[model samples]
Target: MSNITRPWWKDAVVYQIYPASFHDSNNDGIGDIPGIIQKLDYIQSLGVEVIWVCPMYASPQIDMGYDISDYEAVHPPYGTVQDMEVLIKETHSRNMKVILDLVINHTSDQHAWFKESQSSKDNPKRDWYIWRPAKYDSEGKRGPPNNWRSFFGGSVWQWDEQTQEYYLHLFCTEQPDINWENEEARKAIYQSAMTSWLEKGVDGFRIDTVNMYSKPMDFPDAPVQDPSTPWQDASLIFCNGPNMDKYLDEMNAILSRYNAMSVGECPATPDRARVIRYVSAEAKKLNMVFQFDSVDVGQSKPSKYDTKPFNYTLADVKGAISRTQSLLDGTDAWTTSFIENHDQARSVSRFGNDSPTFRTRSGKMLSMLFASLSGTLFIYQGQEIGMINMPKDWDIAEYKDIDSQNFYADALARNPGNKAVKDFAKAGLQHLSRDHARTPMQWTAASPNAGFTGDKVKPWMRVNTSAQDGINVKDEDADATSVLNFWRSMLKVRKNHAEVLVHGTFQLVDENNEKVFSFVKTSLDGKDKALLVCNLSDEENRVPEFEGVELAEAMLLLDNPWEGRIYLID
Candidate 1:
């Protein structure tokens, strides 16, 4: 790689492309490799330098492409390995780097390795997965080996009649945990999984649940929260275990050998000190770690954050992001800033004006905030069009994400019954469904299906009905002042002022601006400066705090001033 292209990652902007919904290559009503090729120009026009393709691997898609059956092949639905090579080559030709989603924590139970691992106790690969004998009561009633809960809403175990033992699965039962403690398993995963892809000249990885590679030796009973619930396992016990660094070191050594870039989707947010230490420059584990404090904005007591209802005023969002930036200061703790991805609700629906009134400004507010932060920003598919959370009126069957569906069913299973299950159903659709984001990209306003794929054939997931009027990408692109343009302008500003935005110290300007989330980013010399103020409120509101700064040439850098504006203060 040329020096210019080699270090380009440090300055590159990563646009996350969800392949299944990015574009339809064969008009098969699903996005594919050829479609990604067709859309490269569009991505380049937006000035993106990296394309983070989120899993195009062969799998049962038990966790929507998170489970891997074949580490080195492409799913037939997406295309051939040749197609991926073409995509990578085309991306490189356009000066854009390519990154793949590295899911090493677990693999499809159908994977040959897992199949062999579960064959019998005497199998050579028997210890290649987290397997244990089922627990039995005095009466000989059998249950999971431990009281762990699967994230998909069940006990984290599946009984195997062949071996008369249960295997653990943190996600769907079809996806079992890989025993990283097994040297053969680790070497197989590293060589066949990371090394092969890295050798293809692709950039690094986004390690899915990276910290879950390690586990607790004793599969203990979980503490009770909602007691009537059948099971619970505090993820902390197994995730980010005592062996975290050892595992990361090994993973990093391979990635480093290939000079690849890496980031860890670490859900383990112990504290600022812990986060800093884990992501610190000397760690040699990853380039960055995605702290979900922003995404998981669910309500929590200071001591615990798992109960949900992450209600946040604009002030809360500002505070959380501001604090995260502060912790990463003076350190090499790179961050992955984003609004929507495979997890969480869409930003438009959750924060901005998905409700019709505040959509444009609110969407603009979130974009400006995340883009301005000092980190490698990841703009999820359709976020450029300001896609919102799923709507309440949609039928329950429209859902495809197993987790949210499981959550809804589990919420309904309580004996005395869940309070406001209907409200939660409404909120879950509006605030947490991954299906809200997997819908096809609305590329053209005039065509049916908004030219995403086509109404002629059904999309795997139901397209958001709102795409008809408000969310078409073509319409927004033509309208220079559209929410899409706000994204364009924000990218432009970041590129123009890269030094101040990417390396400057980030400080929250006003904590009490309920409507305006303000921050000032300053260069080392303090000569370079930029002020970001976003209006997250529904109605018109001026930034009461930034009103003090006197200006000489306050050019309007960008504005969604339906009640928010970004003035280039002089």
Candidate 2:
């Protein structure tokens, strides 16, 4: 048997739940913690070891829960902290672990701390946030501390009339970047807030934008990526700044004392050396990080979402993941694998099959590639059911995601009459949009809303139009060869073959195939290896090249294709 003493994460798969979109118990059209409690069995039945719930803290909902109004209190709409305790207890009742999302780099302007800090220049908490005086131009017009722009829109600074100074906000003007250099702020962050949750028994944390805490002491303008565009300039300064690892080390020290799993949303690292420095297990910084390279499958550049659609092939997808995994191998470092999350469009639409014939097959194919790799696996809600992208024609008024809404508003304000703006929104559908994956879970094929929320109850967003005709968990559960079955079987194989599938050496096998992505996984303990191959395209694949690796004694583990053989290599 696989070592039971190892942490659940060592070889486990996790499922991410966006609380607002997960499930609703009161039929109030909003999903809350009590509703999450109702769905715990459904989550556990998937064999998931960890359930990572996004922020449920007190928030103004401007940027979802990323803008925190109160660090200690749970959002009233989600549930009270007492409800959270019950959910955590329910998660632990089974063998499953529960992880919480931590967003500590900034706080909502509505937060008591920020409210007090912005009260006056002489307030005891005035220095708790990054605030600076306005720089004067030759024309005597006041400018911000620097030319930095907010990730959401125009300027990173909002003037506080009482202080006559501009405060820094990397995201929204509402979320001012906290001064981590302040000892009291650090105390409240790591000691009072973080430990309170840990002491209450949360298993781990998935830190949002973990590298954004530290910044250059002297705030200055960042060299622009696209000089013509200001959006590109905003991300340059904050992500993975100079003092990033210092902040990480300090955070790690606090988390490590309790032996909790720490996964960071890290980006902007130049190379593998930087990745290693941030995530090395011995360094006690981070256990894992979600690299954007694999997720940027269809993008030409890292952050420019509107530029253009680059042609993407299966080999390119395989290549990106292979390179990332290879570079982080054997370094006591690892990465995260997810196809759909709150931040991106759905995987089924972007990479897999949206049609009838290809839907289940492609979902299984992608699941195999991610689960067989040497890292943690994350399954966004509705992914196993093969949920595709949202309707491309969705109007800007339909989106609730702050980033998407801000972009839409910015485009309209810049060029209201421009048809290019229309085309831009359509193309933007292909890049980043939360609507693609935030649809309600499709529980049954019979119900109107797929049995997610009640019929009269208005869901936060509409369910994918395809749920009736294409995707539903009930149908897949009954269909033996469905994507749902494939997902469960894949998890079974991963669990049963933990040594070979989890702690194994990963090698990319086929580089020339345009449509087929194949890799070999060999156990670190020198056990027999397995070939995990998938033809991501629609055409039938017949591989006769690697003939010596025949499996005479091998039985088929899971055949995703309905008509395909369980035992192949014929």
Candidate 3:
């Protein structure tokens, strides 16, 4: 028998909450900490063990709170510091853990550190952020230091005339990348941001872009991805940099002292071995990291905005899942099972059918497929009720996400007066915009705001019209066979068979089946086994035959016709 003890997070189910759109208590048009406190009971009813709330930190909202201006303070629109404390206490009182989004890769340009750093070249805080002198062209015109493109759009460097220098920003210009290479800055981050929250009784964190802390010391130009644009994709050069593991080790050391769990958002890292090093128990870094293979299925190289038509098949989806499922095999590392989050579009729309005819069935199928996977499970807000992408009729002006807006603007500027280019860009936004995930959560069919806020007040984002078609929580909660109810049942099933479902070893059974995703899970002790067969298409699919396994002896444990069928093997 093994003496190793499993962490609480290993078998846990995490429900991700995008605070801005989750629920609004004060009818203030925005969701807040107090609103979350009021919904704790509802969240607990989902059988989730943890709540990973997106950043509610003090910010200018340039990147929707990813650009933190004050590490210790709460965003006034979200709530006061006192409200955050109550939220933590209330969550703990329910015997559930709460993890906040940790976005330390960059800080709002308005951050006191960055403000001081930008004041003058000789400022004591000048080294807190990455700053470089402007490069001169042949004609002596000053430009950014490198040709690296920002994740949102244009150049990664933003010029500040006050200091006559350009500051690095991997994302939007308003968010400046921190100099993690600076020891003093790192120490300050550990003490002021992470340690402060842990001491405040917060459980853990869902670290954003955790692998992006370090960068090459000498700035280098990225290879051009598009001949039309001057800037190039820099993700390959910046992500998982030289000091990434070293910085993670330091962060992990602090988290260890508090016995806290960490799930890092690691993008542009496709190497399974590299991800293992980040999450391996022996490495003492992150507990698990969110991989992007499944989400980046049809996206064009370098940019999600430059997407291909939705031509990806079930095999593509299964292949991504198989790779992620096997990532930690024979190792102490763990993985996170998720298909939807704050940054990604709804899973029902992206992976499963979300039309009026098949939404509920497909949603339940996806729920069962992910809930029974061999790792920690995560369900995004509104996903349990089969929420989908934004309405196709919504105008481009209705899209509020900076990433989507910037891409659309840039696309238009590149091909002015080209109707085809404009239409293509609009289609891409409709399919993949982050705003689709940011829409207000649908609680009921009430007009104006779908009960997310008072009908008299407008929500920060438009509520999906699907709420009127029996997709809201209130309608689904009452329907015994609704997707919401199925999720509840599926979660119970996962908990009841935790050993075989959560900690089991996974093996892909029907490797080449285009429409069927069939897999087997065997417990570590080799005593219990379960077979899960899912039909990834709208049409019915026959379960594949397994060698030496008798279908006659298999007992059906759970079944959803769309289909997610699990059988206990004798």
Candidate 4:
């Protein structure tokens, strides 16, 4: 027998819930802890073993709860701390674990720590956050400390009139970067925020932008990517920083005490070996990390708001998947399998055709693609019913995400009086904005709000019109061949063949195929084997022949017109 010891998370399927859009129990136009509590039975029916709720902590909602002002308290809009405790208990009663979104990389400008840090240069909490003196130009004009651009837009450094100094904010100005280099600050974060939650019965955390905790102390200017713009993308300098490993080790030590699982949001780091280090079992840093190579395939630039789409092909996607499949072949490192999340646009709209004729077929095909991969599976809420992107005719005002709003404002300012530039930016946002994923969940066709809330009350975000066209859970759950049902069947197949589907060796077949993705998985003991062949396009494609496998003798396990075939070796 193999000597491998698998962690509980390895076999668990995670369901991510964006609380603001999941389900509103109080008819208050927002989804709260009680809302989630009401839907525990529905989630349990999906066969998911863990629930990863997005940030519902006390926040100003500048970044939609990412700008946390208080870690111990729940946002009043979401519910009370007592309500959260009941949620944890309810989820556990269903034999499911709970993992909250940990946004320790930064805190809201209104956070008490940031308020104290900005009070004065010599305050006791001044060192808790990064603050530097302003840089002066040749003309004596004061400017930000560095030329690094924020992920949301504008300069990464925001000038503080109170302290007469500039502070770093990798995201929006309201979210200030924490000083992980400070020993006292790190301990305080561990004890007050992390330890307190784990003690309250949370299983673990889904660390938001975990790789951005550390930064270069000297704060050097980023290399210019576009000379036309004043600021430059500083992802290279901010991600995988000098002290990333050390900080993760310190954080992981706390998690080990409770045997908690950690899946960090690690973006922009493409080096396979470097990515592996974050999840290496021997390092004991993180249990797994979410990588972005596969999702970044179609973007022309690092900025998701770029006006032009890249010349990416199906082969580019295949290459990314192939690389990730074999990334930790001989090591004990682990990775995550996901396509849809709160930060990304819907996968069916991006990867497959989302048109009227092919939406359901293509949605099932994409589900098969990810469920067959070897990693901890993560299914975002509403993805089960095949939600598509926002309507093409939506006005810019309908987009509520801060990132989308900032990009539109900057694009208009740069190209004044140019309607063509404005139209192009708007189209890009339609195809790539995070708001597409932030739309309220579609529960039924009974109302415009999709039954997420009462018919009289408006939801926090508009529900997609497609919900009225049989794309909601109530309709799909009743249809045996619906996309929602296909997901249930596919996940069951993965669980039934865990030996080959989860821990088996992955080998790509016909890597050059433009329309088909084929791979084989063999059990570790070499006793069982399976082959997965998927037709990524709408048209029919022939599967390429493998050198030694006999197709005639294989037993067909699962088959669908859009979804490819899975065969077991006899």
In terms of lDDT, the best-performing candidate is: 3
Provide the clash count, candidate 4. Answer: 0
Task: Note the Cα lDDT for every prediction shown.
Answer: 0.77, 0.76, 0.89, 0.88
- Give per-residue lDDT, candidate 1, residue 352: 68
Estimate the Cα RMSD of every predicted model relative to the unseen true structure: 3.1, 2.6, 1.5, 1.5
lDDT string for model 4 (1-570, tens) is 345677999878999999999999999999888999999999988888999999989999999999999899999988999999999999999999999999999999999999999999999999999999988999999998889999988898998888899999999999999999999989988987799999999999999999998898998999998898899989989899999999999999999999899999988887889988999999899999988878777774546867554347888888888777775588888877898999888988888888888889888888888888888999999888899999999889999999888888888999998999899888888888899999989999987899899999977888889899888999999999898998899888888887788777788888888889898888878898889888878788986797787888888777876657888775
Worst 10 residues of 1 by lDDT: 299-308
Q: Candidate 4: give the clashing pairs.
A: none
Worst 10 residues of 3 by lDDT: 300-309
User: Where in model 1 is the C-alpha error above 4 Å?
Assistant: 1-7, 299-310, 415-420, 546-548, 552-556, 567-570
Error of 3 at 298 (Å): 1.5
Which candidate do you rate higher for TM-score, 2 or 3? Answer: 3
Report the lDDT tens digits of candidate 1 across residue range 303-345.
1212434467777687668766775577766666776787766
- Candidates in order, TM-scores: namely 0.93, 0.94, 0.98, 0.98
- If the candidates were sorted by their lDDT against the true structure, best first, what order would they fall in? 3, 4, 1, 2
Q: What is the lDDT of candidate 2?
A: 0.76
Relative to the true structure, candidate 4 reaches a TM of: 0.98
List clashing residue pairs in candidate 1.
23-31, 298-310, 299-309, 299-310, 349-388, 349-389, 353-358, 353-359
Candidates 3 and 4 compared by lDDT, better number: 3
